[model samples]
Target: MQNEAQYKELKEWRSQHIQAYLTDNKKLNQFHDELMRKVFNKAFQTIKKQSGEPPCAFLWFVVGSAGRREQGVASDQDHGLVYETKSKKYETYFKSLGEELSFGLNEVGYPYCEGNVMSSNKVWRKSLEEWEEQLLEWMDSQSWESMRYLQIFYDARSIVGEEKYITTLKNKVHDFKKGHPTLLRRFLDNMMHVKKAVGPFGQIFVEDNGAHKDSIHIKNAAFMPYVNSVRLLSIKEGIHATSTLGRLSELCLLPGYKELKPYYENFERLLSYRVSLFKASTTYDEVHYLNIKKLSKDEKKEVKHILKNGRKLHEYVQKIIKKGC
Candidate 1:
């Protein structure tokens, strides 16, 4: 009974409803998550159909930024697999399934990590016992690569399978940090070298030449440094906060960190500004000059103040690292 216009309107309404449903529902965040989940479920179903062991035999974790729930719109996959000690026989099959899941997600939109940090990577897909040993080894040796590995592992959050695996991983990380406080200091030092936009003369830092010559490496310069600092602080204080904001909140309770409260507040303001700018740009390109022309005078002033505070926080952390704390 509907005319062509009515039919078109109804179709648009239905699409909007589906999009809203997906956004509101936790299960469907990224196209990759949905695709990977389906692939894993199908792999498990295939095993079940063949009267083989289920894939749920291991715990699956989405690590790094994704694990910390600070993923950008273009986040790549960073995941790990931890199977029970007794399920070692199915390691190859589980790893193969992980690779398949990675491939499927890549096809759906999420790109494969250039660092080879995906679940499909043999380094990440391991049994619980192996993971424990690897973690201990990394903690014992204070190499840059080892520290990076621990940083990723410490930020891990279980996405599927048993919860106890994540609990065990947390315990392991806590123990490692408690035993080797120096590693945390080392991590902080590495993070400080990753600079933000503002330069020494109070000028906005930018590339000198190329297509992205004047653009800011927002992830490397600003966000990653903040994320790493929060992570280092969290590990030192035995705080299990996964997100940067959550870590900042936890830091407020720690002694001698009461001054950090204002910094955290300013950090949120700056983050919001950056996110707004990113949305408006409609591209994942690096931000060059912040368009103060678009903002009111008051808004521009506030942004400048917020950035100044962020720099202060960075310098404070730098001192803490130098002091071996």
Candidate 2:
């Protein structure tokens, strides 16, 4: 099928059925996964019409929330491309595919990443060897930008082509960390501070002004503590899973990380709370904003409890990583 036809089909499906999945996080993400894979495959076919056949095997993968299988009702694109080898001919062919995929996803409703992390960027479209080199460069760099890039890439999951490409790249990161144990501290410093949600007075903070005035930024203030802390622990332990919950599960099995079990429950509740509260969101920003006035007293109390536990989880991971390093 042509790209426009695929886009129309996807848009129709989303408009008619997305509302049903919004209240359930797992189902919603599964919906995104299916839609994205269809786009990926169709984009390839469209590109093939122009470029003939692929010059080499390649992988197109998603990072960020999509990569972790934790997408909201509204999400933007965060993806990259990795082909088997280097050459100007291969580069030209895959670059066209990358641009097609990005445009295709956007036309079908996914927004372009503001950070420009999409596969359409030259930095994110690389040969396998180039990707390895870029990973090493990011790993060795002290700059915050490079570290942020590294962390973003850590969450990548292939949506099309060979999965082993991503697996190999992730293992490279793990091996690098293992050889340079102190790199964990750098990661710790980069990720340790989460936005303060609850105040010393035990009141939750809300935006003082703007479109989301009086609303809490739940994604930053609550979700990141659990997500980033668990991610750090996963890196330190050489756990290769990308999802926060998946990392927590792997952690709970280890002798050193049995204490993480409660935090697992807390994170689970956080996911449920987010999806339940944000089901009405029609924009990406709205998905992260929770207006305090709309929440029931019991719901507010539950949010406070989750925020408190998130802080505790953050501190626990910090202490453990510091002690081990």
Candidate 3:
């Protein structure tokens, strides 16, 4: 009754037809999200059948890559739970549900999060009030770790049951920031240290001596600045789109960004490179590191343009923050 059978179909499609789906980054993410939702529903139904019923209304939300709907072919579980009431009964039920979902995803090729950012982790599973308290504490602390966690939560998207739980919480965050405009600068500081992917003289930087020696860390160098900068601006502007491209398009409505045209073009080029890179990515680790030696002259030039524009984007966002609400 829970559409549990969809998991098998989803897994088979991913395993067998991945090459066909690899062309569009947006479609790839949408496919991943669809499968994840099926997985979550199956876990919920399976758990409830075994344990009678949930003690209260609860919602499951996805975070991290899944939350943004911007995942690559290989992504892990990053999720959380928000039950309506906090009690021993509800806690036990949701935690059990969390483990089932995580294990279920692992069985179907998606890895468990290395950081344990999954709903199975106690830190990520909470009642609605507890989550509100936790968010407030995180905002108050303003430590590096707190900021990291807050950013993760800010990207969350509700996947199953009581979607408003996540929506209201997201609204709370928006309101908190609205009341505290200066915090954008703090977030800007946290995002400023993107690794230098392209060096002076337009050279592509690579790892010199490691397992991935001579490979470029595209996640940090190529993707993060674009994603992170767009995220900061979207948050400041209260634009609710989560995907990098979606956020950029929304930002276009503001002055100085015409249809989000310029930045979107650069990010689109970068995404195409990432998609092409996936053809050679046999393993998860291989997806985020580009082989500098492999890029043709035009591709390398495009990569440099992406890096330059990304830096420009972040600097522009900083200026917007300084200009204030």
Candidate 4:
């Protein structure tokens, strides 16, 4: 209903507001969660009004890496939806509502997920019962594909949804793990593939080819392995802590993982180091490494030691998986 002039003015005003908010690192960092929650709530309310439905009638989740609360600045949208049991006549209407929400998100600068893992995708938009069956099927098989699917699902935490639905999913994961030890093994084996980031001579390996050439894949090399390892351990221990750092803390108190406390400390240090380096880089697509020549001998030695300990931790995780931990 807005004329062109008013629409352009509003868009410019929003752009300026976002720029000002983001430019102040301390304020933006402190307000990140609050801002995202407000954005999602606004989107939900707008969609509900358009669909003429009660807000509590549907569940929403921010899925994938964002759902895991491990997003980088370049992350895209990955979301899911579950609706209450409704008459067949309302199915199309709910589906349209999902599409509207997805489009609205894109307007707000969250790019659509390249893999179509959005709420607009029927595969991800489902009834609560359908979501349960999908999870059960993935847990039962533990094939390469199944493990891949579960890795994404394992990261899921509800952003906006029926609280019971989130709890139900967590309970299902615990129940499934209780009887499916081999599935755990498969997941661990898949996680071990993350060792590709280490070089043969104990150096941190950066990609040598392709568009990402000469840069370390920080997400894959450092963060994903750490996150995946924590996920595997948490699932085995029946702990539902969602964040990688949180999972490590919870595992420290558990009976069998007492020896892993030092490893967790090392992991935390490496994570902080990587995040700081990434934030300092001029480009988000490239990893930043301190020039070896710029560092004192002692600093160089410390860097090497950190990398060695990280590699060792990865190896230790492999051993634990071999022993069916």
Candidate 5:
């Protein structure tokens, strides 16, 4: 795994990160960023050795948790590649490079994406022209599944190669969104399900079946409201920042706002809650499910309070977009 100097340094840093997280949880995100840079470099060296440096310019980007810089101890790979030019030979070169990049990271840690959202997949690897065309097609269709992938693209950040390649795509999305604002309704619609964190009776909605029986899905139930709502706002306002909190920070300055960014405040609290959940977990899978039964009376109250705020923020943002006011 440590075939390179950077990878060896990353291994040492990861060990220190594990120890430091005991005192401060925020350090984990920083470590993930450093780890990804090294991984990208490793991928590059592997490609250079095997393919003799890329024949053309390209960009490599990450999506999902790594894209958001919110990765926990265990995560999977969700990445893509965009080459500067499109050609049969160049595409062939990139297709091989994509496989090398994917497996190279897998060799160290991050498992290949279960959904095939990796560089090895054709859908995630393309030329700049193809990416722009694909984005336009997805936005035009306004389909839930298509829009979902579009949202994932919103989280993309370059790990290797020319970052402007990724920036151009982001700006294209922002530009397309400017003229077609009504798409907000469809975007809002796509975000409207599977976000249940609290019941109508003002209680935590724990799972009743499956392996996670009696546990709450912190990822969807708690985090998605903040993530999805901020994403919709970013799409509407054309903010390019990928993180949910970063999105909220940019939105808070919009011309007229009487309230303190409650959504922002609440999201910060939720991150702390997630850190607590991760600290107590013994396995990677356990990090997603918070055992609400373990929370004290006061902690339970705060959880419900945060849940209620999330629902309110999402509804408020939806109304704002719907009115176009």
Candidate 6:
């Protein structure tokens, strides 16, 4: 009954304000944070009714876009749990809490992660000790999937519980990368293939067929290159910023990374274009596809510029990392 009531209130609120929030990425993300935090608290209350109390301290941190505080209206779940210790009792406690949190978030309109990156998955629900070991294992593995997991984990931000837990673990990743310079190459390889968004003729690429036919994949084509390149640099410098813009801001301060400053405006423009162009939608996947058909001539020209720059940014970062190596 409590869950149902809260879900209805949240859904109603979202329906009312989503259009306004769509125009402002920062405010939209803050709204997402508020909604998720409320769900977290409600999940806690629900869990307490079943179990007495949490056996120990635990943190619920978001990853992916939510972790970076950059969510479109149709965002899905990407979160994990970090408990204080490695005990079966504590594990059981958090496991239930994790399930409840996922269920609650889904009820309020956030879809479940397709990759099962949510806390309900045991792999993402871990003790502090386990997380450290897991991070080490991921760094050491060097497999494509492991590297992808490491990248996702790097974006984690604690919305509830001790923020230091994530910081401590992230610092460990930084220390590992510093000790093993070759690891940077692996990071580079993991994201080196920037999807081509513009043709040799300078025309913007769009989907060839299906429902989103003729629409550009803004997230992959425009967003990923910038995101992946900046992330690699951040990893190299041990900068802990999760968002691309935030990472660029920190990178701008360093002497070697000064080249990244100009691209900051490019990224800001990209973010604004995304929010202003895409309206609130029902599906998480649809937000990534921007229909060029609806865009004005000036808007299309701006998108082309952004896409071309994104490709250049990918190449520039690649050169920088390779030169250092």
TM-score of each: 0.79, 0.96, 0.92, 0.79, 0.90, 0.96
Task: Write the residue-wise lDDT of candidate 5 on 1-325 in tens digits.
Answer: 1244445555566556664663343677776666767777776776677768788889989998778766666667899999989898888888877887677666556777888999999999999999999999988995788988998999998877889988899888888777887677778888877566787888788889898887887777777877888888887877888877787888888865435388788888888777765774545577788778888998889888888888887887778888993
Stretches of candidate 4 exceeding 4 Å from the true structure: 1-32, 86-93, 209-213, 280-307
Candidate 3 TM-score versus the reference: 0.92
RMSD of 1: 6.8
**How does residue 26 of candidate 6 score in lDDT?**
92
Query: Model 1: runs farther than 4 Å from truth?
Result: 1-51, 86-88, 280-307, 321-325
- Displacement of residue 149 (Cα, Å) in model 4 is 1.6
Candidate number with the higher lDDT (3 or 5)? 3
lDDT at 303, model 4? 52
Q: Write the per-residue lDDT of candidate 1 for residues 1-325, one digit (tens) a residue.
A: 1123323333343334333323321322343354446545654554455546654468878877677765544456788788876365577677666776576555444568877888788789888888888888887876788878888888887777876877787788788767766767777755656555665666666677776654556566556656777777777777776767778998998788888888677766656656456443422343323554456777756765665566677777877766765
Better candidate by lDDT, 5 or 6: 6
What lDDT would candidate 3 get against the real structure? Answer: 0.81
- Global lDDT scores for all candidate models: 0.65, 0.88, 0.81, 0.63, 0.78, 0.88
How well is each residue in 1-325 modelled by candidate 2, as lDDT tens digits? 2357668887787889888887777898989988998888778888878889998899989999999888888899999999999999999998898898888889888999999999899999999999999999999999888888888898899888889999899899999997898888888889866888999999999999999888988889888888888888887878888889999999999997888888988888888887887777878887888898888999899889999999999999889889978
Model 2 local distance difference test score: 0.88
- State model 1's lDDT: 0.65
- Where does candidate 2 clash, by residue pair? none
Clashes of each: 0, 0, 0, 0, 0, 0
RMSD of each: 6.8, 1.6, 2.8, 4.3, 2.9, 1.5
What is candidate 4's lDDT per residue for 1-325, written digit by digit as tens?
A: 1123323333344455544443343333334344445555555556566666653366777766566555543346777777766445456655766676566556555568887888788877777777888888888874787777777766666766575676687689888777866767888777666556546785656666676555555566556666777787787777766667678889989887787787677666655554444444433344333344444676556655655665566677778777874
